[model samples]
Target: MAVEVVSGIVLGSREYGERGMVVQLYTRELGRVGVMSYAGRGNDGAKLSPFLRVLSTVRVALRLGRHAEGMPKLVDVEEWERGAQRGWSCEKMVVGCFIGELIQRLLEERVPNEDFYLFLLERLGLFAAETQDEVVFLMVFLLDLAKSLGYAPQGEYTVSNRYFDVAHGAFCGRGEGEGADVIAGADAAVWGRLLDGHYLADLHDVDGSQRCRVLYQELRYLEVHSGLRLSLRSLEVLKELVG
Candidate 1:
């Protein structure tokens, strides 16, 4: 097969055969793809372990594999960019992990959407250099990703409509099924603005609990619409860091 060059960040990996790995990436062109690496140390595939490790960026040439119909094999690769990943604070790393996990779980395989890819790449760039906005950053990411992936909730929050429903992707009034898993009150308001693409400065002032509530509500909305579940292992650590 012909070589196709793509640029992206390593999402995560799992051990394959005894000496192999299936490394997944969210790419600018290919969306989400996995490349097989069984080459011994010092070889092309093995060289990727370090570069692909820890959220580093890479540009790689991949060709369709013989064994799998769609999976590709790593041919030639180069570090597309560096230093930014190393410079991210421990907290930012957790955010990065959350972003990576979200990207991996939400994106379908092989399909490509350059707009979503660039949007993701740009956000990672912001998270690297920007600080004190981590929670809002995650909130914005969830909003953007939701919209980009068609999970964005509709409607505005108002005094009468005090609840935002996740499954329905819209705001509703009390007794209108504010039931379990719904975002209510100020949290709902904030999420409503987030879904509307409004990033008011006041968003930065919301206290930890409100911040947590809005964040989790947006997350549930995203997950519910996407039908994806996340372990979110880094979430508590991330919350502590941001707070």
Candidate 2:
């Protein structure tokens, strides 16, 4: 009907035409939105990169009578955050891309998930801001993401039973639960901290490889529990690079 203008963050974009690029964005008001911009190339191409984190003041032309599906036109894109010019290690960049893809796949557009939206923004900003010690950040981000996705494993850690079955996301001591692997206290402590929201802010003193292991475990747990089929190529590359 009428054109509506809104502010949105550029989640990802790719070439769609000789000059136009299709952009996916997360808006505070509209959730995930797709915009096709013809003027998004060249010197401004930096604005279309994945996780460019730009804000667009867009003029949207909506199609009527398409309650569930229809393409909307986006006009007047503007750079909001200016995520360019910052140097990120390859691993950091990969992680950022992974986060964007994860959101794009798991989250439905037009539905409000404010908590998840805020969490993603914060975590992305954390990745961008932290120049050192990203392993901890990755671990913490995954754990928090699991919780948000409702796939967080359940457990309580005690001195008597400290090992966690990576698949179960729970503690299994000697002779306990069938098919449960022994859980280590260190892993349990890390998980326990996750329950407290401490893990989201930082991973403390853990090393890079160790962080990768934890991420693998958490992702495996999510795969088994949530059944969300996600490719780990980027994560695997990051792990090998850091290790």
Candidate 3:
């Protein structure tokens, strides 16, 4: 088998047998992959434990095509030193898990999207810093993710046509069928600002309730486009944390 070294972030993990684990990783070179690792009770287990932590970044040596069914085997793992040990607050942890789950659900297996991988890395850094408005950060990240998936809401906003048609993923004028999917009025205006590249710092004047409303609209837009019920488990936790 050919051995390859790659950088990845742990998306999730589960125990296998008595001394091994099956881990889901989002790799820079291989999009998403499942690898098996043996980490029994000893120094070896201690060394590999960090790699199983959700959102932990690591350099791993994978024995490609090791399994008869063609699953990769994890030969070795080393946690990257840069910002590796920064402790995340409870809120950050929940948000990070939510992001990981979203990626795992939305992406296909073994399809490399380097831009999205780099975007995750950048957002991880920002989360580690823990200095920005977390709610706004998440909203922006979701918008960017939607764009990467090729179904982001249209950024064309006019004073007259301020209603965001979520089902169509565009801004529209006041008309019939302006119900849940049609974000109109003040909510539409805020959503437009987010799509126009206004970051958290630029949105200081906006209050928390309005930010939450925009976030909900953005999520609804994504659900409409992707056709996936992203009823994320950590969503309630995130909402409580942000509020």
Total clashes for model 2: 5
**Could you give candidate 3's per-residue lDDT for residues 1-243 as a string of tens digits?**
211122234333354222222223334454433333322233222234334433353332222224465544333223322245355443444455456555555642323255655665565556556556666767778887788777877757788788888888888887943677888888877776777643454677677778767777777777788854454333544454455
Against the hidden true structure, what lDDT does model 3 obtain? 0.54
Write the number of the candidate with greater TM-score, choosing between 1 and 3.
1
**Which candidate, 2 or 3, has the higher TM-score?**
3
Ranking by lDDT: 3, 1, 2
lDDT of each: 0.54, 0.49, 0.54
* Pairs that clash in candidate 1: none
**TM-scores, one per candidate:** 0.61, 0.56, 0.61
lDDT of 3 at 164: 82
Q: Ten consecutive residues with minimal summed lDDT in candidate 2?
A: 58-67
For residues 1-243, what per-residue lDDT tens digits would candidate 2 score against the true structure? 222222234343454322211223334344433443323434322333343443322232222222234522222222233244244444454455455544444542223255655666565555556445555566667767778766666676667666676666676675564553444657666666655654344564666666666667676666676665554443544455445
On TM-score, the candidate that comes out on top is 1
User: How well does candidate 2 match the true structure in TM-score terms?
Assistant: 0.56
- The candidate with the higher TM-score, 1 or 2, is 1
- RMSD in Å for all candidates: 13.2, 14.0, 13.6
Task: Report the alpha-carbon TM-score of model 1 versus the true structure.
Answer: 0.61
